[model samples]
Target: MPFTASANDFRVAPATVTEWKAVYGEVETVNIVPARARISGTVVDVRVTEGQEVRKGAVVASIEDEKLALQLRAAGARVAALNSQMTNAQTELTRAQDLLRTGATAQARVDAAKVQLDVLTSQLTAAVADKAVIEQSAREGDVLSPADGRVLTVPVTAGSVIMAGEPVARVASGRYYLRLSLPERHAAEISEGATVVIGGRSNAEQPRQGRIAKVYPEIQNGRVIADVEVSDIGNYFINERTLVSIPVGRRTILAVPPQAIRTVHGIDYVTLKSLQGTLEVAVVTGERVEIDGKEMIEVLTGLSAQDEVVTR
Candidate 1:
């Protein structure tokens, strides 16, 4: 006959457990901008130093071209001279017309004077137009920033000569992002807007929240690449080629050893070992979680904390 047991016959221990699921994610990228010179000239001044913050369209430096300056001055003088000539031509043309009407001057002389006045007026207009072009070139002498960003490099000195379309400084714009790669199998599970956890060497416990922004179209080296956007990280100034980990999703359920659970009468059940005796408790099972290379079924119900269950 089976031995009889009392409530004190069996010992029980409380187990605090939580359910979790495994997921996969990938790393994303941030881009750095390199500012280039739009016009050619000597560097006049460097206003902002390296690592300094700058605003959009701010003048980072000035370029001086003596030739351009002389051209502008000559254009201005030519315009003034043409304007005086145009005034004198207009007055002479008016007097010639008055003399022709009074029969003091011949019509042919009047016609010639009118033609001369018209030619001088056209020259004056052309000179004024040329002066406007020179003034515009003078404005381009100052090197203005293309966008708001921090200065990364100022390659030219005040006297250094730079060619047109050459790069003057490099700037990194916008918030930094981490670029990472994930296995192709895991990439399919991640979608845009999915939340993830980022892990690094320094802050292991303190995880940063990130979201899936994009996934690459093609697979490379049996892996799919993606970009994750981190929020509220605040200008951490991450450099290129930084490694990071991302969490995709979470799972929660009651876990039990696979052997401890048995299928009977088409229902899942667990044998509970209480001090009084052994009682068979019916339960609902969820997705299996692998712990220490052992399979454990999630316990849905019919089990409480501190309950002793048989494990084979």
Candidate 2:
């Protein structure tokens, strides 16, 4: 019996396609910057956790120095004492000036009183400045993120004592990319600006694409390091593993759409629209491939590029 064919038909042709090799790549950021504590203190509050997204200048954690509070108290006391002394010196200066005007006190005594008032005023200014310094140091305890990114790890916890310049949280800065280490032998083929398919099985129907933004010059451990830039790879994990298909070479082959091929009893068959009529021909199909966002099947044998296969 002749097999009925559908309205749509596919033409088999030898099209040059990229031959891809699958390799594993880990998600990584371009820069890993740490948010450090500007002052030595104990961690008081942590506003962020691992895998949390943060903006630039956002406070990641807060550190509190118990000693800073004590120092501030001492500074306040000194400032208060100097202020009191300055007021008394001003009163004495006024009294000495009045006595000199009445010819009761010597000019030297008035001069000494004026000098005492000036010295006390300067001392009060210096003490106030010292108090401000302590307050500023206490405010520096808040650790802030240097860049916009996701927090990769937090090494400090509440009540943990950390010194100045110690990292409280490490952030993965900027968009995520897939870092791949390919075999050294394929180093010659891999180049910057090349296209790569990302995150799909061995014959994915609709695979996402990525570009090789950078290629490392030196090979490490018999592998060439490369970075692939995918626009929306996400920042869910820092070292998440995934597979990528990179083009290593190119090949020419006769391909037909999957709609043109029908499988029966494990043997793949395709309907051919010949001059006589629609004929069913046994075709040995290879891997199911994705070409230009369309699903296709590789015709290994029993078919030629000139044949017109009917879609069924």
Candidate 3:
């Protein structure tokens, strides 16, 4: 039996196309600073929790300072003792001067008293400085935030033992950007200042345009890494995964309606309609692209503009 074909046909025309490669990556901040404990002690208090926002120089946690308190007391005592000794030396110098004026104390005794007063004055100055240093160390027991951002992780809880210079909390500095990993083959195509489209998946709420900020020199696992800067980031959380697309190059290709393409067995074909007769033509397909909300199948080969294909 002879099967009738649809009279309507689609004319193929070369369309200017830009090829985009979809890459998977995560949302991250450009600056991430770890807040560390300045002194070794048991965690006494935590002012901020995970996901809490903090300002620069804000106190994040406090360490136990019982030992520091004792040291501070000892320092204060030393300073007080120096002050007492200075006062006594000044009194002795005054007595010696009065005796010298009366011809009761020798000139050598007055000179010795003046020297003692001067020495005690210097000792007092040194003691006061030492006390100030101890106070400063005690103040550092309170951990502070390094930057303005949300706390990502707090590894230690209250009552946890911690060491000096160990990171207690990890923070995301709120300068959000995207980190993408692509194949090493794309190294030549991507560079700093290139355009990147983010949130390109079907479920994405809004597509965003980003600029490539950096391209890492080292390639690991056959993949190249790049960082992108984006503007709209209030809706995205740190470390959230998203889809990114980068354009490699532009070319001209034939695009046909979806119904014009047919699958027989494992091969794709299109029905060509011409004055000669109807013929089934084999085609190699590329991406299914959407233009202005209209979907079209890209013809990689076996078709060109000026060819007419049956729609049904």
Candidate 4:
């Protein structure tokens, strides 16, 4: 044993590792739907603004139609009038029945009175139904959210006249994802369930993991689109642009532990072992990485699979 410098020699060999490509992913919603007005009227008030989270059936805006109010008033008056007429007819029918029993009126007179009362009763029922129909129409003036989501667009404002079925707000519902577009050249490398890196190589923090949830079959504009499902992607801002690293391909290269390579004056050198002689050789190094829980660095040049490296 000469000194502590003498250590176990590792044979440097070519190994395949995933090649990553950096791309910007846009945060988007899976479903974009509109909350529409249920009835044609002037928007009286809007309860929500853009980016507000709302639940399904929550009233986003209230609409009012003067015509509907007038109709409701008319219906109320008609119901009132029908009730008065029916009450008078009931009194007349009771009096006529009394007269017929006392032999003071003909049976036909009492029969006619009873028919009049029945007719008034039916008219009163019809009037009440019409009043309820008008009241329902008034309630429909409250524009409701179509689904539980964040409101994206609210084009109409208070006092704006809009028609029935017109959009009051555009909502983004369902789960959010990072929509990535990559060049068509890397299409074959991407597949569902493939691991993805949340941040690119520039980020020093530990990369968050994501999965390829879906890959679109159609290639448009020479680009391949994919939906990545990151567990905490929902925390990202909608439509926010962020960088992600995807496994575009794989490459075979020689790698060795960093302990084997010693740097002097910015030049990297490693101890080489051979049958003829052992010497320190200058080696070109690539990016530093960890493989199998061991610190390793890539040897871009001055290295071969036949070379055995000793810890410096």
Highest TM-score: give the candidate number: 4
| Higher-lDDT candidate of 1 and 2 | 2
CA lDDT of each prediction against the hidden true structure: 0.68, 0.87, 0.85, 0.86
lDDT of 4 by residue, 44-141 (tens): 99999988999999999999999999999999999999889988898898999899889999999988998998898899899899899989999999
Clashing pairs in 1: 7-275, 27-180, 28-178, 28-179, 28-227, 197-247, 254-299
**Alpha-carbon deviation at 68 in model 3, angstroms:** 1.8
List where candidate 2 sits over 4 angstroms from the true fold: 1-13, 200-206, 259-264, 270-281, 290-295, 304-312
Find the 10 residues in a row with the least total lDDT in model 3. Answer: 1-10
Question: Which tens-of-lDDT digit does each residue in 1-312 have in candidate 3?
Answer: 012223578677777767789887788887889999998888989988888999999999998767888988998998899888888998999999999999998999999999998988898888889889888888898999999999999999999999999998988885888889998988888889988888744564678799999999999999998999887755467878888889877777777878888999988999998788898999998888865467888888999767878987
Q: lDDT tens digits, residues 1-312, model 2?
A: 011224687566677778889999998888999999999989999999988989999999999999999999999999999888888888898999999999999999999988998888888899899899999999999899999988889998999999999999998897889999999989998889999988753364457899999999999999999999998774337777888999998888777877787889999898888889999999898887766677777889989866878886
TM for every model, in the order presented, reads 0.68, 0.84, 0.77, 0.90
Q: Give RMSD to native, each candidate.
A: 9.8, 4.5, 6.2, 3.6
Model 3, residue pairs in steric clash: none
Question: lDDT tens digits, residues 18-46, model 1?
Answer: 32223333222244566666667888887
Q: Which 10 successive residues of model 1 have the least lDDT summed?
A: 1-10
Model 4, global lDDT? 0.86
Q: Where does model 4 exceed 4 Å of error?
A: 1-8, 200-206, 275-277
